[model samples]
Target chain A: MKSFLQPEQWTMAAASHWLLVTTVLLSVMACSSVPAPVAELAAAEQAILTAEQARVNTYAASELAQARQKLQDARAAVVQKDMLQASRLAQQSKLDAELALARAGAAEALAVNDEMKKSTEILQQEMLRNQTGVKP
Target chain B: MNYLKRSAPTAVAAAMSLMLLGACASKPATPEGVINARQQLNKLQASADLAVLAPVAIRQADAAVQEAEKPTKDQALSDHLVFIADRKVNIAWAQAQDKHAQDQRKLLTDARDAARLDSRTREADLARSDASVARNDAERARDEAVAARTAAEQERMAAEQARSGAEQDRLAAEQARNAAALSQQEAESANAKAAALQAQIAALNAKTTERGLVVTLGDVLFDTAQSNLKASSSSHLANLAAFLKSYPERGVIIEGHSDSVGDEDYNFGLSQRRADSVQGYLLGQGIAASRITTAGKGESLPVAGNDNASGRQQNRRGEVIITDAVTASN
Candidate 1:
């Protein structure tokens, strides 16, 4: 029993090793086989990320500039003895800066989710090829 | 598994926080609402300023209201002042009219008093004139009475003078009648004396003429011897008577003679008786008695003287007187 059990253990160990090896190999092959498309996909993703970051930066800059201009108008109204108009302009500039900050955060989160979906589709194609013993 | 669990919880928490933040940020602040809030604040500030200046603002509003109401009050005051002025002028005019009426009454009273004085003076003058006329009438009546008395006196004097003249005329007529009576007596005496003288002459002639016997009786007839009528003488006387009868118409007067004797009265008595005897003898001879008147002459009327006896005888002789003559033819 021990002998039999030892042979089975050895076969299992071998199969397990084979499976590990095949999986590794298939992963390597698959990796190697789609390497240019992956590289193009990564470049497209980087370009989308960069365009989103620049849009967020532009929004942030416009909001900060409006805030700065509102503060300057407030100071000028106070000097001209128009305190009521100055306070109204200062409150409107604060609200525009907070809306620009929220739009930048939502654009960064949508780019990260697009990268995860590409990874999961590649894993599912490899498993099907192994089962059908067909060349994907 | 630990990483998945931790990351999933964290991601859910993060998603919830983002949604809440987005909702909070999405509501936009409007500029119109800010402007409305500012206007409300400005109005509140002005209300506060008005409260601080209340005393000055209220005084200014009151002054404006007083100025707007002034013209209406001024118009009413002017109308009342004009009414008072008109009343004062009317009172002055009425007083002047009353003064004029009083002056006219005084003038009329003065005129009436003067007229009464004039009438009294005229009546006094008339009374004086009437008194003067009555005095004049009394004087004229006195003058007429004096004239009547003078005329009566003159008439009485004239009557007295006429009576005296009538008495004087009666006395002169009585004296003339007495003188005529005396002249008639003297003529009668003269006639008697003439007859005696004629008888004496006649007796002497008879003795001469008759021639009878001469009886001488001369001596005897004387009274010496008593010659009275003797008886012889009677015869002689008778003879003489007879002679006288022859002459009848002749009246004879007788005479006697006487001688110187003792007394002349005795002698004259003897001569007177001789004459008487002769007359008686002649009467006896029938002679008419109315033819003869006898008277005695006495001795005073004797023609002869008485001294001698002859002369005495001559004176004593008787004589015859013829007193009347008769015509022989008748």
Candidate 2:
């Protein structure tokens, strides 16, 4: 007994299989391509985070330096027998140092939260593309 | 069926390419952006609150500082100092009043002492004046007593002389009576003459008024301004004395007068001398000196005016005014 399927039908079925295999490979390649830029973007984001932390630390250090200078001036005024001016300067210096330290902590928290939100948005877009087999 | 089978793979390939492109284009929102937007909203709210309250707060602070400094700079401190000074002035015034009262008391005491001394001096002077007046009165009384005693002594001496003269006349009358008895006709003539004299004496005693005999010697009694009696005036006085001797109780007054022709003082002296001459003749005839009073009333009491010689002769005549007691005794 001989086979009944034609040679052209066999060629078409083989081409279809080849196309599915190529799409799967391309998708994986696209997914692999995302890691190089994503890795570079993550490094850039990390650098930006370090720069922001440095700016916050510099602001905190500058405020602490100004507070220390003011405290010294207030002590000098007290030595000169000017209690009213000394008390006002001491209170202003303490409030400015505390506000600068709080603002530095808030900037560091905002940087870390921004990095997590970018990573989650990339993951959710990948999931939606896999389930629908369509463009976003 | 053939056409559907020919387009199915191509459609799936296109859908897969679109899904991959969409996945690559998606971007995520960051927390830094959300926080920056919230901070900007809070800064706007703060600016609005500051705009509402700034002008009112500045005005309130300025007022509070001004009120705190007002009490230390007031301007009336000098008036308070003056009020305190017046208390010391009042004390000085009280002391001055006390000193003035003491001075017044001393002045009054001195005035009283002066008045007492003046009164004592006046009383001493009055006592001396009264003693001088009393001495003058005593001297006047002594002079009056001496005059009265001299008048009484003169009367006593004249009465003694008249008694002695009367005894002598009695002896002479007795001798005349004896001589007349020797001749009878002579004795009868003497008795008749004695009887006539006795009747004249009785008639003088019967009269109660003033009475006396007026014998006018006329111009034959004396020369001009001379007090001598002529021999003819003497004989008439002798007869009058003889008649007066029979009546011892009868008194005689001899007076002289002068015309208004000479000085009144000289006429008075001439009249007094003429009266004394007549008194002397009566004494020679043995008339008692105690029974005669001699006086001169100078040309003052005149019976006639001195315009004619007859009137002047009448004014120059003498007069005798005998007292009633003497006539009654005669």
lDDT of 1 by residue, A8-111 (tens): 33455345533443453345445454211222222222222333344656534564455446545644543444444444444433333333343344434334
**Residue pairs with backbone overlap in model 2:** A135-B19
Candidate 2: where are CA atoms >4 Å away? Answer: A1-136, B1-213, B321-330
Q: Just chain B of model 1: what TM-score?
A: 0.31
Q: Which 10 successive residues of model 1 chain A have the least lDDT summed?
A: A35-44
**lDDT by residue (tens digit), candidate 2, A28-129:** 445554212222222222222333344645535665555456555654544444444445455434433443444454444444454545544554554445
What TM-score does model 2 score on chain A?
A: 0.44
Q: TM-score of each candidate?
A: 0.25, 0.26
- Interface RMSD (Å) of candidate 1: 69.4
User: Candidate 1 regions off by >4 Å?
Assistant: A1-136, B1-102, B105-107, B163-226, B230-257, B260-315, B318-330
Q: Which digits, one per residue and each the tens of the lDDT, describe model 2 over residues B183-298?
A: 55666766876688557644433223335454444545666677787767665566557656765666777778777878898878877888888888778777777787888877
